[model samples]
Target chain A: MRTLAQVVSWLALAGTLAPSLFYLAGGTTLAAVKTWMLVCTVVWFVTVPFWMDRAEKD
Target chain B: MAEAPPSSAAEPVNEYEREPVPEKARLGFKSFIGQYAGEHTAGTELMIGPLFVASGVAAFDLLAGLLVGNLLAVLSWTLLTAPIATRARLTLYFQLEKICGRKLVTLYNLANGVMFCFLAGSMVTVSATAVGVWFHFPMPGLNDFFPNSIGWVIAVLAVGVMVAIVAAYGYNIVARIANYAAPWMTIVFIAFGLVGLREFLNATQTTLNSGADLWRLCETAIWKGGTPLPGQVKFTFWHVTFFAWFCNMAMHIGMSDLSVFRYARKSWYGVATASGMFLGHYVAWVAASILYALQLLRTPGNTDVLPGPLADGAAGVAGLICVIVAGWTTANPTIYRAGLAFQAVFPRSSRYKVTLVTGLIVAVFGMFPAVAMKLLDFVALYGLILMPMGAVIFVDFFLFPKLGLTSFYAERTGGSFNVAAAIAWFATLGIATWLVQAGYTQIYFVSLPGWFIAAGLYVIVSKLHQRLAP
Candidate 1:
């Protein structure tokens, strides 16, 4: 479960950056990048809490 | 049956505030790296980056200045601050108490705490800008000093109250959130720069086929060096360099970070500050500058440097969220620290109440836009005010024994105040302030001479005091 959460967190991190890369490279619209980032942000906050503070607990 | 008093050894220690950190508790280099990175890349960077653009810094000057200045800052941490932190393994407060005495350290705490409140207030202003984006309220402009509208006041108050309450009650939760948000916020800041650059290119219909073309774009469209905006100091390469180097002078040269670095296993771990300097101060500052430049290109007459509108224009809602999170994360700790400082001054006071009051005071400061708008000057002044005591500590630690005077004079004498240290701090401040007021030096450059002045005064005064008192 922790591994899954970590993987999702990493992907969400990548997801936040990916749209901007696409926008900068000229294919995607700024609107699309914004939308994608918002989605990634939600995913991040949801999954990250599961594992982000676990190290301190252990 | 009354339970036997809990074993003193079983009680968790209070971060080793009054003693050296035990070897078993020393942290690795990576801990400092992550900490520095998160702490530096904050809401204020958004304000600072835009202020650089407003100051009319050319591309070469900004880039080269930041490169050299940040290098100097990192070296200061590694050489000046870290060695003492590792050798003594003590908090800055405790170290200062040893050298300057308890009463003087309390005075220093008051100064430090007040400065923290103002700094946190600026963060509140930054976050409030985000609130303005949603609420369509009139926010403060670069030159405006007062709250401009009812909506703006409400926005600031709401944000400030939320932040204060969280800091007062849910500090641990906010800290955890800050940790989770750090990496994400950093990436968003980078995205702001990229998206702003793309927008500028599209607006200008410029194609970057070569390095020369990009340089031309940056020089012509981005950092077109010219007269500074009204009420801003014109930035030269020297100004940029000094600003970057001394921006955190209080932390490094002022030895505030001794508290943070005391847990390090090795002094060289101070080099880990590079992660923060380069990523937050360099890249984030440059990125923020690009966004502000884009704002100017779009509306030549609109000179308001609101981070919320700036971020929103670049990355939309994500940008707004970035600004708020960045502001809140930074402000949370700052408010907490300020509360602790205040609580120390009023030892019997409840920490939660002190922190809540401190947060509200910061919010009030936020309502006035001048603090955030003039952040460059405010930061320089903050560093200058706190920097002299660092010199005192340095001299007391290294030079006193050589001069045949005892180190930790106050500790040895069991005094509540050390007159020599007090003279050094106040006299240096007076001289430095006079120099700036007399137009002999800019605030950005005053600290260099101020630091030397402080060291000299400390030694001379200590010599005189010891001879007379003994």
Candidate 2:
């Protein structure tokens, strides 16, 4: 479960970054990039907490 | 309210304040990398990056200056700070107490705590600007000193109170949140730069087929070198370099990061700071500068450097969240540290009550926008004031033995204050202040000479002090 959480978290991170690159490359609108980033942000917060702090418990 | 020893079998020890970090507790190099990357890429980067643009820095000056200055900063951490930290493995406060004595350390703590309050207050101001974006309140401009409207005042008050309350109550939770937000916030900052760059290119109809074309766009549209805006100084290459290098002088030269690095398994792990210097100071700062430049390009009249609207314009809600979270996370630890400083001074006070009061004081400081507006000068002054003590510590640690003088004089003599350390600290401050006031040197350049002055004074005064004693 933790590994799955970690993978999902990494995807969320990538999701946050991809839209900006797409917009910069002239492949997407600024509006679309902003919306995509906002969604990725939500996913990041939801999934990251499951694994990021596990070291403390270990 | 007595603090537990680090070696106590109890759960969750109080960070080994008085004793050396145990070998088992030492952290790996990766820890420092993540820690620096997060800590350095803070909300203040938003203010600082924009201020560089306000100072009318040219393209090469801003770029090359940051590159060189950040390299020097990383080296300072590796060579100057980390080596001492790994060997001593003691907190800055404890190390100073040994050398300067309790009374002098109290004075130092007072100075440190007050500076932390103002620094934290500026973070509150940064966060308040995000609130302004959402609420459409009139935020302070780059040159505005006071709260401009009732709405602005109320917004600052509301944001400050929320931050202070959380800092006083749930600091650990906020720290965790900050850690989680670091990677996301770092990406948002990159997005800000990219989006700003694209907008600038589109608005100016510039095509970047070559490196030269990109350079031309940066020179012409982004950081056009000319007269500074009203109430700002014109920056040269040296100014950018010195400002970048000395901006965190309190941590590296002033030895405040001894506490953090003391837990490192190896001193060379200081190289991990390059992640922060390059990623945050270089990338985030340049990105923030691009955003501000775009603001100027679109509306030639708007000179306000509010991070909230700026971020909102770039990446929308994500940008606003970045501004708020960045400010809140950085300010939380600052407020907590200030509280600890204050609590150390008045040992009988409850930590909760002291932190509550400290947070409220920081909130009051936040209400005035001057500190945030003129952060460049404020940061320089902060580093200048605290840097003299770093010289004293350096001299005592390295040169005292060679010079036939005892190290940690106060600790050796069982005294509450060492007059030699006091003389060195005060005299250097006085000289540095005079140089700045008399226009002999700007605040950015004063610390270099001031360090030498403090080191020399410490050696001379210690000779007389030890000779005269007994």
Candidate 3:
């Protein structure tokens, strides 16, 4: 369960860095950044809620 | 019948005041995503980007440094702040209440609120410049820290009033404004980069345009890594990295954002900060630097920092609006947070009224030109001032038990003021000051090591204080 939590945290973290990464070489356009921001926003929005506890669940 | 009980009359109660932040307002994860992104991608980009150019950081450093530094900052929050916040679900105010006691917290709140006011005031001043461009009022120069004219005073008042009103209304209002302003502000920021490039090509009268040319343009026209501007220190990758990471040191690593992030559905919601880090810090800062670089190219003799004029040169009216609104969006949340800090100290006072009062204080300072004009120095100073408090909190959260002293010792001992917290706070300052006076490091360099020094000192002092006190 702790590992699962860590993995989810990592994925969410990936979501945050997505905007910056989009600025990297392969997709080096501002449009690419927006697309990645939107995509990551959607993915994280869906994935994060599942992990948020009603109280504290470790 | 009228007599009080003897036992009740004889005893005095003094446990650390623990105002566990009530989870009354349940905001979704999306709210936090927007809040962090919007807060981080603030209006200060107009100033910061240009400063980077002035600092003369190398291209490798400017680009790679921000990437690494920002990543380190995000990880610091997720790994350090979020876990503790979720576990305790307390505001820094509530947590500090236990450590600092009621009287000392009043002092801390004054310091915290005042620092925030100055910060918000600077943002207000930043946007006011854009308004000056629109109105054609006289603006401040690099050397002028004091308000130069009646025009400057009025412009800041007008801008401060509008921003404070919106913030005073509530958090939802601030969120809405950020939501609307962020996308548009980002568009204009990018346009700044594109339009400035066209002008650079026009002025130089060159034809070859490839990725190398683009990179070359950034190096020569934008960053132009060189000697420090007259009073400024040379910024390299290390400088830029640390600045980017610690710029909001109090908020994340210092755990000021506990109040903001407590509403998050999941602590992982911290991932949302990327939007601001990349969009505002990485992209927008570079774009504004390009604009500043273009300005330097045109008026090589001029050392003035007029974001309004620089933006005007690049994208005309849109740049002006972006600067003005950029300041407002950033300042709104800041003033709100400052007010909350003050309210925590006073407990009985209405937060709205105190924040409005705080807004007025910021506005009065906003009338001064120096704080905004000499931003780099003020930023460093502000970070240094707040860093000690952050260090004490970090230690109390993580290291107290390991030292064999009780965490929240003030609460346990019924001591209104923890002498140890007081020692750590001032000792760190004394050392940082001595270091500066001793000619060891620039003001900007003191914050990181200062944070650790504070945390360590607090542990040692708190242990000793507890042992020595009966």
TM-scores, all models, native as reference: 0.97, 0.97, 0.81
lDDT (10s digit) by residue, model 2, range B1-470? 00000010111225798899999989888888877878877888898888999999999999999999888888888988899899989888999999999999999999989988899889888889999988897888888888898888888778778877887898878888978997898899999999999999899998889999999999989999898888999988999898888888888888877888888899998899888888878898999999999998999899999999999999999999999998888887788788889999998998878888898898889989999888888888888888888888888888899999999899999988999999999999999999999999998899989989999999999999999999
Best by lDDT: 1
Q: What lDDT score goes with residue B150 in model 3?
A: 84
* DockQ for all models: 0.80, 0.88, 0.04
Give candidate 3 misplaced runs (Cα > 4 Å).
Answer: A1-58, B1-29, B169-174, B207-209, B344-350
lDDT of 1 by residue, B96-135 (tens): 9998899999999999999888888889889999999998
Global Cα lDDT for candidate 3: 0.68
In angstroms, give how far residue B451 of model 2 lies from its true place. 0.8
Q: lDDT (0-100) at residue B448 of candidate 2?
A: 89
Clashing pairs in 2: none
Candidates 1 and 3, the one with greater lDDT = 1
Model 2 bad stretches (over 4 Å): B1-13
